[model samples]
Target: MTRWLGASEVAARTKSVMKTTLRSGTGRIHFLLRAWRPISSHTSPVDSSDIISAVSPKTLQKGGDNGNFKQDFMKLKQPRSSVTTVLQSGNSEAQRTSITKLRRVVKKLCKSKRFERALEVLMLMETQNKIRMSPADHALRLELTIKVHGLLKAEEHFNQLPNIASQKASSLLLLHGYVKEQNTEKAEAFMAKLKGLGLVVDPHLYNEMMKLYVATSQNEKVPLVIKDMKQNQILRNVLSYNLWMNACSELYGVGSVELVYEEMLSDKNVQVGWSTLSTLAKVYTQAGLVHKAFAALREAEKKLSSGNRLGYFFLITLYATLNDKEGVLRVWTASKAVSDRPTCANYMCILLCLVKLGDINEAEKIFKEWELDCRNYDIRVSNVLLGAYVRNGLLDQAESLHMHTLERGGTPNYKTWEILMEGCVRSQNLDRGINFLNNDFAGLKCHD
Candidate 1:
């Protein structure tokens, strides 16, 4: 027979185990398996999923009332007022819904930058329900509050919740907010407080501190963060290694960066990904090691996952930076194989790379291809070729392209106007520039 542990009992044991693991050089796999074990030595532990299944399946299905709740939440235009009214409008099902379901909804909204709505949902869940708010929940609300309001308001909210201040999650969120604002004094002070409380057991906390150092151009402090992680026996993740390598590149040059890379490769836990290789290539390119950069890029290509558009974009841009036109074309061709039809952004990326390489003829061919495949006329796409013409002193071609875009129902944005204004000034056409600024496009500023 198995017995289920109370939530509080499980949480206490987990926290204690985490602290113990932090002090020891325990394997991450071993630590993770031990972290959630039951307090009892004899009885087997019942899984939380099984408990949820036995209790009430309809109340929540894996942190939600299923997909319908998310769809309904998304349809809410005025979530602040509507969320509470809709949820509490004599709907017994919603009224009886679990906090986990509500928290998941809040997270979904937050992920989409709908912080105002997310905050509202979280507030409603707390005020309307009898369910207890955990430390993680408090942390989430802190993050949302920071996004919706600011750090001051978020701190006020955090201070009001005295119980959560001691928890790792909320404190980490506050530190993250401090880091995001680049508040060095507050971040360092708060970090010291967290360390004193023994809440800095996780590598994520150290990563956040390292990120703050890097962001504020305090690159020398990054290695110190790695040292702290080592002292604390916290296993460093990929982000940790990446940030350390970047700081090394900026402060110590390519050789030091390569040394960091070598250390990361030897680490049994961290899987070396494409982005890491790309970073190496970037560092090599910046140091003027063309052969080394090419070698790194080739390795990066093999590391790239299937259908990764962003990875191809990085490779294409790097190849262009290295003036390897063949490499750029090759990556672009490979990129097309990943998708049935490339996105407008993909077309734009390739166009920019081709234009940078001074392959205007190739760019023109791509622009035509985009024209044929495009469902909607995108003015931004035309601006790429138009800007290329203006930059190359082809004022006539620029004008023709502008007129062509106008005829195709493409509306000119501020960028398109700015390009034309720049072209006019370069060609000594003051009257045309004035006309563009005044009559043609209202509120268009003349470029100097």
Candidate 2:
């Protein structure tokens, strides 16, 4: 008979086995596989694909995902080769005015992700006004800030620009700005504008903005959001329910979270997925309502057994949180049974978890596996491995990973600099770290 491991005993067992891999991008978390009693000794270590079937009597489909960013955001980068007109003959004042106008347009184009247009405007001014344009002037600072901090902060500064740029800023632009400010009033006002204009905010917008107000817990907006679905004729898609479900989980109980989901499920128009269920389950786990969480998982299993492999992962997370080693193993084995084609993220999570668990053997396996998987993902994966290696005191590996990141047409960000610098300091390799910062990072910042 399989050993029945209790919650309290999980930590003891996990002292040597519990692990969480820090994946590169996708949220696959490697955790303790509670039921996976490593039976290299057993002739059959419970078929992974079989247990997965036990959860759902449906079909099993295998696939892949974009390694770093979300699938919806993974367009490839293309280069532009247009030559610009130069403004070398204009007088100083005229040149400055022309350059300033060009600079404003450049910023506007950048905000719209129309980098080509911005560059074009800059070139046009340079060619016509006889003045030079510098991408260095607050361009990198603003660009980096927007990419790192996000569209919201960028919008504020973007909004201050001329009408052309402001017109280019979409609801995404405004929503991002509100999210960055983290100001409820601004967030609500912006959302209200979207609603007033008869536009339904996307799930992403609703979550970011709603998460802010959930703390107030007055939450009268709950029904209104649902009401907006009918009023505005949006079917309250999975993301819509998720934002509200997340809120209910925080303010009330799993019952509240389930209520919204249940309502959605009853509606023939609303289609939910395992991801939504997992997100809802997370709230229950966080609230210490494990029993209810389990029930929800079972429900998900029933609904999506033949659909997605996320069920096994959700169970792994739940068991990991509970410190249930056997349970974690069970889920891991089940997940693997469905497909061995793990994403870079899944490998990363497993690696981090093994590291945390001090299961170096498992961690090494994860690292090796991820090394192979990272090849397709380019710099993002390399950077993650570099950071992980540095944290684990593998200096050689970190250096190699850093070099690999550059080869993939991706520049290391400030976070990379800080992590490597700290790694160097710890290893007492100060000069090398300083050299990197001075020669590489500093030069990279020259554009700033």
Candidate 3:
């Protein structure tokens, strides 16, 4: 007969025994087994009769009157087996749902810029071996790893992937990672390896290679990428042509840009966007082809709707570049008329153009008008006018405006002081300059 100890008595004795066993240099496993064993165990001092008395008749009958009490006690002691059985029954479905939820969470985390947590989720999924990662998933995980832990970790992850995941898309992602790290040699080598593998390299990959070259200021290598694209017979899109034009313009000059432009124009398959036209106009301006620049701008305008601020803004800037006063004013008027609400940027453009053209009186008048309606007072607008005044040797006007701005609780930036100091030196007014440095401009905070 086993005597069943009360719950409190059992707990206290178990704790004491565990402490004693641990201090005696016995292994913890022995204490744990002893502490957790049922009172019916042969080593326990409790009587079996106490346990038998506590058992209901139904339970005794279920175990059978022959009473294998130890077996019944063992069944009561281990509940984990039944719990594990229940857990294992629906495990596959639960695991599938968990994987699905984890993938969704990873995507959302990545979008929210929580890259570390996103990578942790991905690692958990990988360790669990419950989710089947597609090529895109592998690529995304590599990208996230690159962003969070850096390129070395991303490379390790990529290398650990199965051969099936080493497809063209995943390879492209790794190549992009190398490009981001500015490892030109590794990027080129990896790209070449991809080609050697007989992977059908797309135009985007070539574009990425070209972008890498451009970013590195290795402009000479850009045309080589285009040449490769041509040899591969990959059709050049507008983006490709633009990259070629930019590389050519930088290395060879406007003539090369023109040649590329002509080729792009003749290629009926490529649709010319406003960006293409803008690029052409800029290149023409750099080459001093004023009429050509105007023609490109006009064509850009034709493509845009009347209400398009971009077209109006571009027209004003190009005209200002050519010093076409009437054209700038005309385009500005047209923009203001069509725009429901003109932004500060639009007003700044017109003001900057007016100041650059040396129309000080008109700039002042426009500044006054803008001041009345402007919701935000940008110091940049004031700086433009101040710069014009200093350049034209109108130190008196600049000083007056500076003082007025200060009176109105406006803060002058570093450029403003520099301009005033320059004006003082230019005019040979050393005393006024010393005063400015000591008093007016003293303790001025410079913002970057």
Candidate 4:
């Protein structure tokens, strides 16, 4: 039986032949490989299959047969006299035309998702007439490689390009991908390398990282990034302010959330509108600070009155809490209660309280008649109210509500999920339980 070489063997063979022709190839390859460590981070039960595929032969190809390759190597081992004999007989314009055609083909390939094909074109162009891979070109190749096949093989191509000013930004993005698996330390090290190159880490980069950390609930990391933002003189955009505020709320509860509110409010250069108030209002309510929550609710309402009404849902909660039936009814009626209505915690609270008072008739009427009251809103409240129904053994209502929640562009969050899982256990909804257990809730993209 003929033994087939492993992927690494193929890559090594191809890389070896290619490296021999280029002076700085080894250094470039090393830098690229180190950069890919971020996104390919897997520390658990090591997977050999992934390794094999990562080191696959896509980035390399044959220059010649083994026998011919050895003969060419023997010839190349000695320095030849500097002669331009090819130009004396060959059509130079033909070579240029061929290279131009390859460029067009490669450009189109880049637009499509065929990364390996594009790399093939580049390598082929290089083989015909040594094409220098610019930093931008290398970075593009690295990005596509990682996006299509994972981070394993991206570095191989990345390292072949010389480090230049143009490569700086693209390099950071590649490094960002490396740390995409939430590897903070490695990402920071890569970020520092950019600093060594005289590129300051901007607030947007920090914000992007902050989002990743927040998703993993590493809320404590928010402060350090905030410091980086300040040092870089990167102005905080609305989203950055929102993210920092969110981090504060997660850690210090309402106190930190309020502090963010104060910070946003103090910035005359910045516009602290609906989203800021919306976030703070939600945090205050969740932290059980009804008074402070209502204060945020009022702040939202004032700003919204001048044509931005995104915070209408938050206001409904404050009104619902105080049992201000008129305030709730007034807003509901003013909108004709048909096409537009705010559906957040406040509305859900009203529904829950109405049910608690044995006013099932009115609640059902709202569910059936005031259908648009469940406008495009966050799904958390629906899940929360559903939890209340589950506790009280309101089976029929919970079932209908759950179905409606799904229908109205609401994907269940972890909180909603835990409640459903518990209900499934308590009510013994076996089919629902099995289905829920097997469901890929996290994969549900936001349609809203």
> Per-residue alpha-carbon lDDT of model 1 for 124-156, expressed as tens digits?
555545546777777887888787778998878
- Residue-level lDDT of model 2, residues 1-448, one tens digit each, is 2222232342233222112211321233223234222212112233344332211111001111212111211121110111121133234554444345445545655776755444434433433334443435334333444554465555564444433323233455556656665667877776776666544434555655555555456465765666755675655667667778877765677778778878877978667776677776688788888887776665565454533565666656655665555555555555665544766666555544544444555555656666565546434445555666777777776666555555444455566677778777767757666655555554334322
What TM-score fits each model? 0.75, 0.46, 0.59, 0.46
**Cα lDDT for residue 239, candidate 2:** 65
Best by lDDT: 1
Please give, for residues 209-283, the per-residue lDDT of candidate 4 as tens digits: 787778778989887888777887777777888898889887887777777768877877689876688677778
Which candidate's TM-score is highest? 1
Which run of 10 residues does model 3 get worst, by summed lDDT? Answer: 78-87
- Full-model lDDT, candidate 4: 0.56
What's the C-alpha lDDT at position 296 in model 4?
A: 71
lDDT rank order: 1, 3, 4, 2
Worst 10 residues of 2 by lDDT: 54-63
Summed backbone clashes in each candidate are 0, 29, 8, 6
TM-score of 4: 0.46
Task: Estimate, for each residue in 258-298, the C-alpha lDDT of model 3 and write its tens digit.
Answer: 89988998988798876688778888888889889888877
**What is the clash tally of candidate 4?**
6
Mark the regions of model 4 whose C-alpha exceeds 4 Å error after superposition.
1-143, 154-180, 215-218, 250-257, 301-448
Candidate 3 residue runs with Cα over 4 Å from true position: 1-183, 196-200, 212-219, 250-256, 305-316, 329-350, 361-378, 400-412, 427-448
